[model samples]
Target: MYAYYGKEKIRMQPLHLLMERGHSCKLADIVKKCLRLDLLEKVTMKKNSALMMVVLLLMAVVLTGCASDDNQAATRTITDMAGNTVEIPASPQKIATMTGPSYEMVFMLGGKDKIGLVRSDHATGYPLALLTNSDLPNYPTIKGVGPQTPVNAEQFLDAGVDLVLYYNNAAELEKFKMAGIPAVVVNTTTTVPTTTEEYFEQSSANLKLLSEILGGEAVERYEKWYAYLTKNVELIAERTKDIKEEDRPVVYWGNTWGTNILSSYSRGTRDFEMELCGGTLVAPQEGGQFPEINKEQLLEWNPDIIFVDNHGNAPELVIEDMYSNKNWESLSAVQNKQLYRIPSGVFFMDKGSTNTLVLLWTAKVLHPDLFADIDMIKELQYYYSTFYDYDLSEEEAQKILEGWVDAENLVR
Candidate 1:
């Protein structure tokens, strides 16, 4: 968390306190408070009526005094994929993050204090204190990504956020711009980045952009995160370098649905760690996307080891059903009993800061003979602490992963 001395304190809680004091607070007053804190640049109101303008100006004056940053804050205008120009705020105070994982990224980027509101689904695991506590104002929920529910422009407008962050197809910028919200789009949907360099570069660019939005001490803290991750990656690369290409195992990734989707170290939807650890995928099919292979293909390729992404406890039933079939038994991984469940916190998340850590930990796990000192639980606690600033006890982290497995069982 950033220091409490600045304008952040007002956005964080003082508004609720003012309301509780029996004074009816208006949004203009809050924006004034924001401006007084030097949080927002004063702009002439073109749409609001004169009466509203007086109230807003007063509020802006009050808020302008709240911002304490003495440094010359950085500002920039970046174009979205759709070519819309977005003028990013310097030290944005109230940011609405719509994408579920964008919340996680904001927290990782040291914008936890800057986050004014999060989408509903992202708030699922939020503690009661953030919402139910009378001392805090009720935060509005923005929309999320997926098929039916894309970004909600009205919700963004209603939130009055200075900036909005989400992960969506760049093509959806039109939907985003309709809200008149300056959005930062993190495109993680790209299933296959051409190379690991491209992947890290993209991820770092997102982090850098977010860090720029959250300047001052937040940027310093975020840099610490970058340093920590860089050190870890270097350690992982050096540790796994000894494992030769020929000696590396051919592994297949399985899910709870008894599906064996072949993975590769080279590129595509293949696990990123598999590539880092020199592991090759068995399926030799072209177009290395996540394709569902049948039992016949499983027998034909016969991967050396199987790593199930499913954290479900009794996924063994699905394993049993597959192994019971004669064709599945013919596979090398099935014959050797080398199949194991990959830890969910790392492999389970599709994309996030946690996903990157999972990649490092997975590289260590896949080549334990060469990287025997790898500690997944320790790594998890470190990532959670360093990035999210949330410490998880061993038991707690285990419960989350096991809980995921249990939930999958219930679904089955």
Candidate 2:
């Protein structure tokens, strides 16, 4: 019988011919078993052979193409706060990071080429020179967001973006949805993550995701940074594990210095870094976000160490001026001169800027005796060069450190 094959007609015999005609036919058996069908008419040997070859060739070609495409897709996965899973396309060529801190992650992953419009805040004070460049195609300039003004979605679309990576904030999620861009939330700010491994696992996973997205040469450099950071965290954890709980440094975090000043003490994702370093919060209380703290309450806690957030009522100045009159000399930190300022440039400098250098700085300050060998300046430069792709000179690092202290000293 003539069977239509593409543009040609081929003669074929039915499957019954194989057994009825006593034909020792391997081809017939294969067709019947593999294809799982019975031919209504008999097929000629030549036609049957050609059909089989065509079928196998078509499958091979299709499978080969599919495998190649699968390989080309960039493989990445992100874990959200609810433990939900998100897999990103491999090697995303156009990534638009909505959050400031997430931009750092993208840069660390070697995604400079793929990066599309970056958050406006990244344009200013971004430590890495490459990121700070205004000429880059993906980053557009957005100004006029004061201490409280929020960013708009239309501005992000104007810059030509693909993905918006950010921390999981309700207000942001709503805005991102309104913007109509694909969004993913990554939570790095946690007050207490319950386990030591749990604390860094998210961060390490984020770095891994970045490496995979960037792919090729960029992955190697990022891995080196990730390895170094992981090693240091492990070292810090091991060293501090043996110290008594009571011995851990008690700290206070000044969020801002305005009317009715607020501070975070073991709060939700806000003071995660401080909490992870085994530092106790000496504030109104623990586990609440940005609780209002009066001066009397701060003096009452009498923390072992105090860290000013940045540039406001400098903790140093507050101590110097109020110490004599406020009965602040009773605090242990006052006696030992442990009062210090978190480097504003690295910490409070930019909301979008992820100053990872602060982690090492925090580690060193929280456990000076254990981490006596740590050189914060050198470490800061290393991270600056590795993650930001800019060589943060020792002079620059020193200036940043001094700037924090100087901000306080100037008030006198």
Best by lDDT: 2
135-193, model 2: which lDDT tens digit per residue?
45346555543223465766655554545565555675566565444456653444345
User: On a 0 to 100 scale, what is the lDDT of residue 169 in model 1?
Assistant: 54
lDDT of 1 at 87: 66
Worst 10 residues of 1 by lDDT: 127-136
Give the distance in Å from residue 345's predicted Cα in candidate 2 to where it truly belongs: 5.1
TM-score against truth, every candidate: 0.66, 0.64
Q: Candidate 2 at residue 324, lDDT? A: 57
- In terms of TM-score, how similar is model 2 to the real structure? 0.64
lDDT of each: 0.55, 0.55
Model 2, residue 48: distance off in Å is 53
Most accurate candidate by TM-score: 1
